[model samples]
Target: MASLVLTDGSQLTSDSQHLGMYSSPTASLVLTDSSQLTSDSQHLGMYSSPVASLVLTDGSQLTSDSQHLGIYSSPVASLVLTDISQLTYDSQHLADWCPLGKDTYFRKFEIYSMAWQNEINLDNVVLAAASYGGPVAVVRDRKRFIKVQTTGKPVISIYTASGRQMSSIVWTGGQIIHLGWSSTEDLLCVQNDGCVLAYDMFGTYLHTFGMGQEAKDTNIIEAKIFASVNGTGVVVLTSSYRFFLVNNVKEPKVRQLAEVAGLTVPPSSWCVISEDRHTRVLMARGSDLYLLKHSEQHAFPVGLDLRENTKSVVEMAVSHNNRHVALFTDLGHLWIGSADMRKKYCEFDTKCPSRPRQLVWCGTEAVVGHWDTVLLVVNRQGEFINYSYDSPVHLLPEMDGVRVLSAFTHEMIQKVPLVVQQIFRINSTEPGSYLLEASKQFQKRSHRSDEYIRLVKDQLNVAVRQCIDAAGYEFDPSNQMMLIRAAQFGKSFVPDIDSEPYVKMCRTLRVLNAGNNHTENLTCGAWCGLVKFGNFWYN
Candidate 1:
């Protein structure tokens, strides 16, 4: 008997010998014998010998050595076999990890290669990406001149995080100031006149709202869109330096915040902070900071002991949880402190006078600052890591991490989860590491698999739990399957272990993996449907 392997959606046919067929990881195999075709994992079709023919049109059949055949039918069933050799080594996943503090680590990895790399120019457009791996919207920046001349109206294009274009429309409204997405994934186009036009994902107009009469009269200077307790919120700063806030775009009830006293000019920088069930405005005036609230009659200055040479707070970002704040000053001093301004974490100097083009928080662990081509991540202890990109990048902060969107690629930079560190950290003695090793050796049919399994036999359940948890954090499908397979292997040794987590994780991964393929076409509601279907089928 001869063994044949099929991968990368290839086909194999042999009429001379009885063959044992296998499909490699992340690939599909198709085989035809005597005009009978069988499909298995992820479009995997296999034929056993020339003596027996198996035909599967709406159903699948498997034959054993005794010639016993079993038939299974599912309208939406798909299987994907895992090849351990294709699984990324722990070293590769660990390579990107950078230590944040004594125990914490962060890593940056590419998520998707932009599908619009050749069509869209990041330099000529203003882009905004939604949180939670949502769609991105981009429109031409009228202020930025491109070599090619075009019509007066620019087209607003919406794309998935993978850069697949969903829909686009020609701009026929007022001068656009910013492009953002609501919590429900609607496109919010903030115009210069303080009017925001909302559009669905398919570029259909939904509704519009205005900031206030004063904002429209004065003309909006700048605006910030933030996630609020109620929903997506927008705060606009008028040319007259007054601020207006709408805590929920869906409701669109605009309120004016307290005026910053003695402020005749625009502050160095400003941000919207949603705290204590109310949204407030925080602005930097020279070296002084003021927190403006809608309930208060006047804006109050936040006292801080600054260095004598400190000139201004150039940039600031509040963490996802609104628990920590990072403020960058004119003298290149970066300050990390509690959101309430009660406790100081640390202050580090970047030694660069130029203000960063974009400053945002990566989860609650670090502050990320992006210049033209330099991307920097600074932790609380002042330890920093910087990467230089060939082109400018946009940062979209998420609940767990930040998405770095560039002209050609989409990436994620975030603090590594502890479960992932336990399994992949170099020279780790954790039980999960042994279980992973055991899995790899088991695939190779090596006797060392037994030894590795024995080493962690006492803690098998712990190892299995770690693998399952780590698999949830991994973005790569192949890596996820690897960890999952290790957990499944470990579960076999623990007969009394609860299988709910393993089953749930497997179903969730399948749905997510399927969803990844059609992100451009699927909405949040569609995703929920897929998840519900998965749950129903599993139940």
Candidate 2:
């Protein structure tokens, strides 16, 4: 029997490491083990209490009292041993505080709101909300010093869906001519000096670029930002009345566009449309509209002419799909047509003779025209719906709807996607709705689940897909879980169903909810509550 002893609390041993011992009030060394120990005393004795020790054995004889195993009790002492979860939540019925319901079952969530009531003056605020539930970027009191320079600078603030301010950057730079968000969530601050600065989600300064030497040296008059396949693109009209394009923000690579012939000043209204891998600028000069592109600069033929009563275009907006457009004229004549102006959908008279404050597309189906406190949405059929906002307002067009931003509250005005309405609408015998009912019955352990499944067995995949998609539009974890559970339950009924879509949506909602669960950690971002209303009012 050999043993080693040390007084300086150091020792050396062979590979087997069998002849070392250490003792202390917190711990005491035992017999042979591969791990080496150093202490003032080296002697053979059993380990003491209070100091937890790691054990490695195949259910063999254990010598320590540290046998409790749980997430809280386990000490992270080994690389191989880690944490785990062992619970499964009941996700069938949605919990209280589910998303607000519009009409029968359309879900409308309170994505964001002002920190305080009437805190923001929407007239002075330049607001932009990125599509697909992206963050909103705001530049307060933006319409300041347009004619002349001022010492005041409006702060640039970015907020998430929960009204939590992700970042607030002091605007000490030049004149912020435009504040917009890129497709990748980078906030682009366009200055009058034609410098475009990019910032990340956390408000970190990315590099800066110029629209063009013509734009920078001669100065930019007006700018329009659009989303492109590669990155966010910007088109600027230089002081020389010439157009320039930065097709991709990442590389910047500026390209000057064809000039509109015989044009002396800026047009009344214009928009950038991206389609078929090509981008074009649609500008209206009085009643004559033109499409300016690298290939051609020609007069855009208005298929439905208002030649007798045509007035100057006041405001115009293109749909997100880049296929349709909404043109609001000074005479309150609103026209919905193709981007090329070749095919006209319908023409609706707003009956408000004055120019509209804002013109935007509502998910490619309707044209939203706002004048003062009254807002009107005229669909392609020329039928319209009116809305009222008592305060200053800004319109944010989305892939699904147009978001209305005022000083006190934020609301979305969108026609519910047809799939959502068909799936969850009351008394609907749609295949997707039946599948959801079947899943609910399955959760209750009723054999009716099988019967319901058999009814839609031919379209089970479509039904599962609809549930998965509806889950994305829901913010409430309980409601999201209910939709996802219905999807899962429906998936089990179809053996050949691809589980990838459902699994991906569940994972996405999990991550989204985890980040959105910051309600408890907020200092000023509060839950402004929700209103279950805004049923579809379409033609």
The top-ranked prediction according to lDDT is 1
lDDT of 2 by residue, 1-539 (tens): 22232222234434214422221223322222223445422332333122223322212222221111221111111111111122222231221111222332112234455553434456666777665445667776545544424555667777764455678787778888787878667889888888999887678898899876667788877888898767689988877887778888888888776667788877888889888778888887887777778665544434447636776887889887889988887777888888777788887777787887788887767778888998787777777667666778777777666777666666666665555556644334567777776776677687867877887889888888888877776555665666688888788777877788776666655555554553522211111111112111110
Error of 1 at 450 (Å): 2.5
> How many clashes does each candidate structure show, in the order listed?
3, 0
Local distance difference test values of all predictions, in order: 0.74, 0.63
| Candidate 1 residue lDDT tens string, 1-539 | 22334322233334212223332222323232323333332232432332222222211233221111111111111112233233223334566777777878888888778888887878788998766677788887789867766665788888877888889988898888878888778899899899999998789999999999999999998988888889899999999999999999999999999998778999998888897688877899989999999999899889986667898999989998788899998888889988878888888888887899888998778999988899889987788988889987888887677888888988888888878777765446688977887887688687868978888899999999999988877777778888899999999999999999999889787767765653434322122223334322210
Query: How close is every model to the real structure, measured as TM-score?
Result: 0.79, 0.69
**CA error at residue 320 for candidate 2, angstroms:** 0.7
Number of the top-ranking candidate, with TM-score as the measure: 1
Residue 184, candidate 2: alpha-carbon lDDT: 69
Cα lDDT of candidate 1 equals 0.74
Q: Judge candidate 2 at residue 324 and give its lDDT.
A: 95
